[model samples]
Target: MIASYDALSEARKALDTPLFAGLPGDVAVSFEFFPPKSDAMMLQLWDVVQALAPLAPEFVSVTYGAGGTTRDRTHGTVARIISEARLPAAAHLTCVDATKAEVNAVAEAYWEAGVRHIVALRGDMGEPGAPFVPHPEGYQNAADLVAGLKAIAPFDISVAAYPEMHPDSASPEADIDNLKRKLDAGASRAISQFFFEPETFFRFRDRLAAAGIDAPVLPGILPVSNFAQTRKFAAACGAAIPAWMEGLFAGLDTHPAARQLVAATVAAEFCRRLYAGGVRNFHFYTLNRAELSYAICHLLGVRPKAAAAIQEKAA
Candidate 1:
């Protein structure tokens, strides 16, 4: 499970977290979920929602699949979270393969449903390895999408940021300029793409500050449930997987249970370092699983109301 016997011991030591002085409520968090295409996945998603509901994240977001492929399903999921669960939910809106009229209509529907937030994006084409092209009649990019959403309503908008620079960007500075444009157009905050090193995010954050853009850019944390899958995701998103990570996950392909502990330990340490660096808000890529995320949050000093009862019993 661990790289070596002493490696396990050292990892546990490295994870001696600085217990949060702030209450869980003081540390704001939000979770991102993708809409389920199958009946079984739908049931499983609700289970995850129920499990994390007690954590009281700032808001939960359901991702819109490429080219608005999951349009109806995304709406259904967001509506249920708002109505059935009585949680504030944000729906992802993408400007790909849809006219501006259609996209604005969807935004109106969300407003009608009492959803007040939107994560605007220039989503990819539905096909694998396909390039993204703007619909002739649709918003041109995320910045344009943010402005369009603002025109419809003053929705609290969140847009994506690339800590390592977007794959399409000509340069990192250009990428930051694009991010500033989105925020200036009306996005309230930017959720960064996931990165392994805290330094990567810190550097990006510094660049944003130096650019004179004043907005919160929350760090996105992905608790790696599967290393192989995560590596591929990272590669696609242009995130670097440092050599150290492979050594940690090495030989654990057949050890799912052990992988959970290692994942928790790595993510908890990641959070601890971020928190120590003065980053307060985090957005987790939950991947429709609760156990790993819940564990990492608990280790970062987040506790549900029910955890208090358990603590009382222990006392």
Candidate 2:
């Protein structure tokens, strides 16, 4: 029987409802951070790292900027997480502006620093809204980067997927094919760009299973901290801003506290639905902030736990 729209919406609401009691106390999570550019920002970054470190994520990643602009800083940050913080660090490596040898050298450095994971990307160049050109000497794209990383070390590689087709992707089918290539080239997992609707991610998961690609495509969740900024970014990233969401954030331009409460509630709702859909792993684009992500993790049955003293101990 075809479920009525009203019925499905009600079912989804029930599925999304948070259980403040008996929260499961276990879920796998990962966080992404960017290398700090200034001393003040570095202090804030470490403060956030210390706050979220107690949650004991499966691993934490530091993002590399477009065209490898933050390459050295990213290496230093991830290496510090490994050497000092006692956490497993994933360094993001991009196929942009650097040759295959340079990318390999970075990977080798990460390995030498005791890092075991890499978030590989075929990054955008020029500017945020400008055209992307593959570097003349670099690996052409993420798939090639993934293949090269595997050849360099037995790294746990993760690549990006877009639930809404990537702007540059030829088609949904081609995007899936690209993802498959990355996986076949030895990527162990795929982390999707953030989206609002759980059904968009669920549908993508169903299609991937149908295509016989069984690697875990983790649902990426971003807790909205600023409505206007989020709307702008979602538009750029090809994610839909649901009308319902818009209505809730309608007129709180100056009301920061209410905005945060509303953001936390909405993110928790989105995640509960995903958890009900059998998603056990989540990657959060934390925006270098923590409260909202921490709250959503709470709703997902994850709690603040001590950091793993040794990498293998947590593994």
Candidate 3:
């Protein structure tokens, strides 16, 4: 049949051609950044935004710190991104160590500052390994926070999804149920925690479909530049780092440039696999560095908007 023949042709191209050759650059991407604590860091983050802006991300998000520690800094960073960079910026707001009134006030301030998108979360505690204890008068969880935000304004909201499972989740089913509750309460989409394996996301997406949850869930991609630090993050978030990846980064500690090249190759291949599987949207956790993310995007055929326009016009 024609369908079977087309499938065979695609497989042949995959095996015969260069992995990154002839990609159409049809994917949509967004980036996440953290608030800077120092003046120098602020400059660095601004440079990063400038570098990645030409790709025309769907939105750039600034992260909220643990227990609302960086509230003012987060607001300032997001405001600058919107006013200065002219990018659609989403501010993270968490239900942690703050009353409902307090959280609502922050949301109102964001609305007044021209921010219409928020990433809602039930944030981690200040202390490591300590269980999250909601404030006595605060929203109980992310679901409650999402509903409260909806009541305050018609903001576009995104909540977190765990592909493996949350460390505190009792079971995978409970995690999915929690995600459902958040979506039902009015979140527009869920951005998953960073995962290394493409199959991890595929299985999670299948499970989401089975649960009858049809919300768009963007896969979070963290191009690993520091293997040792990534291991710590993986341990905290319950994401597994494959054994093969470990061997790739082994003995590259002294070779920073080569390490970045390896990192790009590994992450681009992982993304190409996801793209072949029909994923069109990706979210990158930039960690305030643009090179790794930019290179990966380039390999995936995402060029600057102006460049793409020129190509189209020439054609």
Top of the candidates by lDDT: 3
Model 2, residue pairs in steric clash: none
**TM-score-superior candidate, 1 or 3:** 3
Whole-model Cα lDDT of every candidate shown, in order:
0.86, 0.86, 0.92
**TM-score-better candidate, 2 vs 3:** 3
Model 1 pairs whose backbones collide = none
Q: Tens digits of per-residue lDDT for model 3 on 280-314?
A: 89999999999999988998889988745433321
TM-score of 2: 0.92
Q: Per-residue lDDT tens digits of candidate 1, residues 96-189? A: 9999999999999999988899999987786655777889998999999999999999899999999999887899999999999999999999
lDDT of 2: 0.86
Candidate 3 pairs with clashing backbones: none
Q: What is the lDDT of residue 196 in candidate 1?
A: 96
Winner by TM-score: 3
Candidate 2, residues 72-97, lDDT tens digits: the string is: 99999998887777777899999888
C-alpha lDDT of candidate 3 relative to the true structure: 0.92
